[model samples]
Target: MKRKSSKVLWIDAPDIKARIEHLVEKASIDWVHTERIACVRSGNSSARAYARIWGLNQVWQQVLDVPSYYCIEVLSEKFDHLPEHHKDEILLHELAHIPRTFSGALTPHTRRGKGSFHDKLKQMIAAYARSFR
Candidate 1:
């Protein structure tokens, strides 16, 4: 019998990192520690999302004996083909996941108050637009 398998490759994405830095600055995402964040691209991944945020939780930080850090991952299959504006939106969405505390934890999509995650994301998109104009 033969088995099928998939391979995933992760590589540092300095270009994406640079883009994120610009977005962070333009959007005034003061809560995020841009320096501590890392960006990586994955090839041949099965994830359906355009991008995702991976965080090192407090426990992991303690276990690893390191400070808080975030990894923004872009799946090449989904993200690489997107338009520039779409890519920026996706990047901002991932950045939104990092809570204001910058404690290496993710903020949930559901909010306790009136607005939702999309609401915040929309504001960010608008801000990103207004930035360059």
Candidate 2:
């Protein structure tokens, strides 16, 4: 029997879910067992895409006591039409923000000489190379 699909608001499409799942699997980040990934539509016109880390805030730690979630917000107008390669790149970039700890905390990006973009690019290249061998 086929499995039922999870409900995803805003960007509720099969292709979007598949892309997210593929990126999450490839990311290999150690999110807590209960962590969830959601793709939402971005309301900001200037935003192309961004990953929002949830459950890491003080309220969650002090009250909810639950694992964090990663909400990947894609610009409804832009992301839905991007090429597959571009989507992959964007997803990979977001995944890179996640630390290996998977403890619901984020690895803050550095803006100094070797910035987040540079670091993410390096990691992406390495992962790409490993896929071939």
Backbone clashes per model, in order? 0, 0
TM-score of each: 0.92, 0.64
Which lDDT value does model 1 have at 116? 82
Give the runs in model 1 whose Cα sits over 4 Å from its true position: 1-3
> What does candidate 2's lDDT look like per residue over 1-133, in tens digits?
8545544345444555577675555544335232366666654344333434333554675677765665556666666677777777776766666655655566666756645755765676467546657
Top model number, lDDT: 1
C-alpha lDDT of all candidate models, in order:
0.91, 0.57
* Candidate 2 wrongly placed segments (more than 4 Å): 1-9, 27-35, 43-55, 111-117
* Per-residue accuracy of model 1 over 10-129 as CA lDDT, tens digit each: 999999999999999999888888899999999878777988999999999999999999999999999999999889989999998888889999888997874688878888888888
